[model samples]
Structures are given as C-alpha cells and as structure tokens.
Target: MTERIGIVGGGIVGIAIARALTARGVGEVTVLEKERRLAAHQTGHNSGVVHAGLYYAPGSLKAQLCAAGRVLIREFCQEKGLPYREVGKLVVAVDDTELPALAEIERRSIANKVPRLARIDDPAHLRDIEPHVAGVAAVHSPETAVVDYASITEAMAQDVRAAGGTILLGHGVTEITVDGDTVRVATDASEHEFTRLVVCAGLQSDIVAKLVGADPSPKILPFRGEYWALSPDRTDLVSGMIYPVPDPRFPFLGVHFTRGVYDDVHVGPNAVPALAREGYGWLTISPKDTWESLRWPGAWPLAKRHWRMGVDEISASLVKRLYFGKARRFVPELRMADLEAKTASGVRAQAWGRDGSLLDDFAVDRIGPVTVLRNAPSPAATSSIAIAEHVLQHHLDLAAT
Candidate 1:
C-alpha cells in the first residue's frame, strides 16, 4: 500500500511542498485548506518580489534557499510559460550613517554567491537607473525580479493535482492527533488518517505544532505590511525596485518603491502588529487569538526590545501621509496624491522564540513522524523549491532510520 500523506495549509509554500513530494512519487498527498480558494493569506497578499539574497544573514537557510531558489523560480517560470521579469533592485543609502550597512550587504551577497551584485558609487548611475531617486550611493542587485506568486501557487497546485495528489479546499484542520503508525487529521469537513503528515500551516503553524505534541514552541506573531499604489499617471517616476538599506537591528526592510510585473509601482509596507492572524486591516481582531499573542512570553521580549520602533510603525499604520512621506524620500517627485491604499495588506507569520528573540533563520523542528516549519518569512516564496527538497530529505532520513 502506498503511504498516505496529509498536508495542512494551501498557500504557496504548502503547495510547493506538495508538488515536490508528488513529483518524487513520495506518496498520496492531500492538501487541506480552510479558505474556499488558495493563496488567500500571506502567499496571495505578498509583494511578489523575487528576492536576490540581499538582506538575509550570510550562509543561513534564507540566504542559501533564496540564492538557489531565485534561479529555480526563474527557470520554472520560463519553462511553464509564466510571466516574470528580472527588473533588478536598488538599495540606496540616503545618508552617511546608512553607507556602512549598505556596504555590508554587498559583502554578504558575495558570500551568498548572488550574481552581478555591484555597488554604485556615483549618484549619476543612481539617477540613470532610477531617474527620480535621491541617494549618494547604492547597491545595485541585478538579480532581483518580480512575479505574481499567486499565479505560481496556482501552477504548483495544478502540478500537485496532476501528480495524483488531492487538494482539499474549505477543509480546515481543526484537530490533529498522532498515535502509533497512523496520524489523524480532523478538518471541519471530515477526518483523515494518514501514515505521515507535513504541516506548513503558515500563520497557524505553531497552533498545529502544539496539537501534534512539539516543544520549545515559537509564537507566530502576525505583522501587517501595508502597501500603496502609485497613481497611474506618476508610474513612470519609478523604475525597477527601490529599497532603503535596512536597519541592522530591525527585522523589516525599510519602505521603498517596487515596480510590479504588471507595470504598476507600489510603495510602503510598514510593519505593524496585526490584531488578527489573517487580518489585513485595523480593528479586525479575534479575542482568542489576540489573548494568545498578548500572553505569549516571546511577545513581551520582542516588544521590550523594539518598543520605540514598534510604536512608530503602529503610528505610521494609522496615518496614510506619514507612510507616503517615507516613500517620497527616494522619489521626491511623489506627491501625497500619488499614494493610495492598494489592496488588503499581507500578514507576515514571524516566529518569536521563548526568550523573546525573533527567529531570523528558517527554523524547522521534527519529532518522530511529525515535521513542522516554525519560521519562514521573506524569500520563503523565492526559496520554496529548495526548502521543499530539504523537508523531503529529512523525511527520507527518517524512513531510513
């Protein structure tokens, strides 16, 4: 009898893992999703920028997976006849203080083995690349690109289905219990018994992990990223992706301009604490979920460390002009009128450790028949293929044991 595998979550990462497993003929794979359609959460709402291993720590899973996955993604898109383009990105140093950090990112790129990462020393070059940008110096990463991940997710899900894998929508896994050789997954629709289970629940990862009896558990603190679209007439003011050198101590990349594959420019994704896990806007809070977040020991430590920055981000989320004003630093021609609230926001399922430290790397934990992905943030979409392979290899090792 073929081993049956049940996967929870229907986002890009979940489907990517399913595709990888099915392609390898691992087993009969089934994906469980609560939403009526796929990619309704983080995967659907992401900025759709193909990362170039710029901000990740050198040699970490994020750096390795993103660097390797960028190549895989571009190749997959080309082969599948999907629309994607390497529009490149510019990380500018707006002042003297940010120059060192910008330089460090260049050095890290070399260590991460990203292709054609050059530091632009002349403002003339910056102006040539992005005509209406302000910067003394910048790092030009030509490997960066943009593509709709929702489309990519849909493609992967199709592959999963064609490979004889079943994708079950509106099947939210409400109860998970593992005993002996059979693992039972109870969803709202029905109960499924499988030989093994791989849960990539995204925002609900920790919740599912706890159900399967795992420890040293990290809390998935949902962070809302808000974006604004450039008025159609002013779209020409920005070209390619423009980013600010991130503060070393901060977890987020500062606000900047990004040109979409659709030829529209979007800016600003200021990180703010989200009241709901899947909530895209303010005042959308689940009391139970909010209580869990507030009670988590991990939450207080992170808050204590970045209290001021957190306060500022929260304030920016409430004020639209403050958000756009930050973006205008690069494109001075950008008027308050140029920025308008785009779609619903994307929620980042950021994991925080027990000590309250934000887990920066890809944190995967396995115990017996269960494997759970704890923290997988930016570049996760870019690194989906490589990460899926890693997870499969782990499963293979367990089978050998």
Candidate 2:
C-alpha cells in the first residue's frame, strides 16, 4: 500500500485510476499531466455523451466496460452534484437500403443489454420521440445520456487529492526507464520513480508506448473529427441525440446530432486524417507527424481501403453544402444556414496495425511493471472508470475492490 504509483496523462481515465488507487489505499499515487491542466486533449474535445453500449460487439471490452461505466459515471455525477442528463438517443434508418444496418445495431444493442432498448418501425412512433426526425425505422436507446466530461474529470482529480494522491500538472513525460520491478519517468521539470506505472496518454498513446520499449506495430493514426454547431434558435430541431447507422467498416460513429448537457445541439463530426496529433483545423500541420503517418506500412493499405470515404469526408470538410447535405438526411427541415459554423474539432487517436486494420475494441499492453492503453476511442470517456478498474485488475494484477 505504501508503494509509489505513477500515472501518465491527467485525462478522466488516468484520474479515475488514481482515485481508485488512493481510495482503496493501494499506493502512494501521483498523476503527471503534460498540460498545465487536466482533460486538455481528447477528453476536453469530445462530445460529452455518456453512451448506452449500443454499437459495440457483444462480449467485447467496449460493450462490457461501457455498460458498467455508464452507471458509475451517472452515480459519480450525482455524488459530486455534476450535470448529467439522460436526453436519450435514436439511431434512424432513412430508407429501406439502411434497414439492414439498423437491424444490426438493434441486434448489438440487445446483445449488449443496453438499458431500455426499443425498435420503432412506424414513422409516427419515431416522430413521437423526435418530431423533426424522418426515418422509416430506428433503434432507440432511452438511457443514452450526456454530461460535461471535463468537469467530471476535475471532480475525479479532487477525489484523488482528497485521498492523498499527488497530481502534478505541466509534467509531460519525456522518458521512461524500466529496471527490475521499478519504473522511472522523466519530465522536463522533474523526475520520479514508481513501483507501478499506468499510461493513459490518449492521443499520444502509441508515442508513449515506444518510450517504454513496447512494440510499434500498433501506431496511432490521428483522425480529426470536425463538428458544426446548430444555430441556437434552431437547436430545437433535435430533441435529444439523433444518429445514423454507423458504417461498421470503420470504428467512428458518423455525422449526427447531439443536444449537449447544456442544451446546445451540435451536428457533424465527420472523420478526416489529421496532419498533427493535436491539430484542430486544416491550417495547423506538423510535418514530422504527417511524415511518420505517411511512412507507416499501414498508411498505403488503409488509404486504398478507404479512399472513397476519405474523399467524401474530406469534401464534406471543405464544402459546407456537402456537410449540410449529410446532416439533413434525418432531419429534412435542416437548412444549409442552420449549420452555424465549425464549432469544435477533436482528433481521434485511432490505433492501426501494420496490416492496416483499425482496432475496434479497447487495447492494452504490458511491459514489466508498466501498463499502457493503446487504443481508446469514442466510448473511452464513457468507460473511463471501468477501464481504470479493468487495467488495475488485469494488466497490473491489482484487484480494484
């Protein structure tokens, strides 16, 4: 219990782990964050949807962890007096062509035991849930909710501090050295050693993995998702959250409408390749990052596999008309002008293998006393607490309870 434990990345998942450790009297916990604050990257940038385990494969880590984490997040929010809204989500199929995919989603939702899952075939019934939405069929997840993840992470950090854990901001890990049973981590400002180490470095996960001499096979491919905010006056177009049946070929949930915790609706997060790991816009580029991705063995193969989708997504990013067209599919009432502007963008740290396939499930790797989270996308924030317990129990061989 006295052993010093270090956690890299001050995102929700990392802080959740720290809180678990300190709360259980597991160790002398220390959290090192690169930025001067926590939740600076993907955690802060994502649409704050507390998912209801709808899309993941049955029995997968994402499905299991997300189901468990959703309850924990809601309970945590309630305990901390944070904002948590169960606004519900409806995944609609616009026509007969999309019915098969919508059925698959329903199958997955049922198999995953998503709470209060329902399938609606009548257009009038769908309209009862979302008056503006026009679809022939849909799978509704009434338990799907929204919350401010950054605020939740801050609350988790508070718990860690309250439990005697140290959280060091502005401590971006530069080097990691493992010797026998101890791991030493170095930052620009200071250095520390720990009896156990956990890496939850979201966007930079693969980069950090290499620091500990782990395999570079699963490279982090930064994919930028751009969102357009709905006009404030027109936010009423979306009742809760409206989604398309995801393209299953890729991991990303395509363009959709989500009414946030604060009651503001945002639409469209079309995925595109990011030139820099942290790049939010097209103008921001990192030559080194771009070159590294281009040279990866998976790059060419992935490009060949998804060139059409790449073209469509890139065109949508460049042309407002195209993006609006995609968004207006479910809501025929949407106008080109209803999409105010590009409100915010987040880069997904999509983990890819040398064979050029995206890793759909959560992935973790171990090198001695160090445990690294390599691929954690969309549901990561939703699954943060459960992921912490999972990592502790499986990779570190520490029972969280």
lDDT of 1 by residue, 24-54 (tens): 7877889999999999888888889999998
C-alpha lDDT (0 to 100) for residue 218 of candidate 2: 93
Clashing residue pairs, candidate 1? none
Which is the leading candidate under lDDT?
A: 2
Question: Each candidate: what lDDT?
Answer: 0.86, 0.93
Question: What does candidate 2's lDDT look like per residue over 163-200, in tens digits?
Answer: 99999999999999999988999998899989989999
Instruction: Note the residue pairs that clash in candidate 2.
Output: none
Clashes of each: 0, 0
RMSD of candidate 1 to true structure, Å: 1.5
Candidate 1 local accuracy as lDDT? 0.86
For residue 257, give model 1's deviation from the true position in Å: 1.0
TM-score of each: 0.97, 0.99
